[model samples]
Target: MSQMITIELNGQQQPLPPGSTVNDLLAIVGSDGKSVAVLVNDRIIRPESRALHQLQEGNRVELLIFAGGG
Candidate 1:
């Protein structure tokens, strides 16, 4: 079995398997990366870094998606 870690996402706790990359989380949240931004542990993560960044235990991640309002 793969290791699992607890991460906080948009103020909610989520369990993710070890070796999971940012792309995995983006998929879970149904984001396409075009209109979304990611923050990890209070630091902004660049889009290019997502594919290479692996999630760690007790990480605080926030996903902000763009929405149009008129």
Candidate 2:
């Protein structure tokens, strides 16, 4: 069994499996289909890099989603 890691997601505690990437988290949270801006440790993570950015324990992540509304 693999160990789970804890991360601060959008100011809340989120538990994720080890080796989880930014893309993985987005998919898990059902946000993969939306337009989102991801930040890790205060640095912006581009869309093309989401799949390669691995999330670590105690890492702080922030996801800002864009919505279309008047």
Candidate 3:
């Protein structure tokens, strides 16, 4: 079994499996990752890097989603 790690997701505590990447978190959150900006420790994570960027314990993550309205 994989150990879980806690991270701050938009100011709340989010538990994720160890070795989870940005893309993994997106999937877990039911997000398709489109029109969403992800930041880790105040650093912007590019879309191409999301799959390779690994999240660590106690990391601060902020997710901003863009919406279109007529």
lDDT of each: 0.86, 0.95, 0.93
TM-score versus the correct structure, for each prediction: 0.86, 0.91, 0.89
Clashing pairs in 1: none
Which of candidates 2 and 3 is the stronger one according to lDDT? 2
Q: Whose TM-score is higher: candidate 1's or candidate 2's?
A: 2
Please tell me which predicted candidate would have the highest TM-score against the true structure: 2
Model 2, position 3, has a per-residue lDDT of: 87
User: Can you rank all candidates by TM-score, best first?
Assistant: 2, 3, 1
Best by lDDT: 2
TM-score: model 1 vs. ground truth: 0.86
Looking at model 1, report the run of 10 residues with the lowest lDDT sum: 28-37
Quote model 3's TM-score. Answer: 0.89
Q: How large an RMSD does model 2 have? A: 1.6
Tens digits of per-residue lDDT for model 1, 3-68: 688899999999988887888998877786456789999898898899989999889999887688
> Worst lDDT window (10 residues) for model 3?
27-36
lDDT (C-alpha) at residue 31 in model 2 = 92
User: Mind giving the per-residue lDDT tens digits that candidate 3 earns over 1-70?
Assistant: 9789999999999999999999999999887646789999999999999999999999999999867778
Q: Which rank order by lDDT, best down to worst?
A: 2, 3, 1
Error of 2 at 27 (Å): 0.4
User: Distance (Å) between predicted and true CA of 1, model 3?
Assistant: 1.0
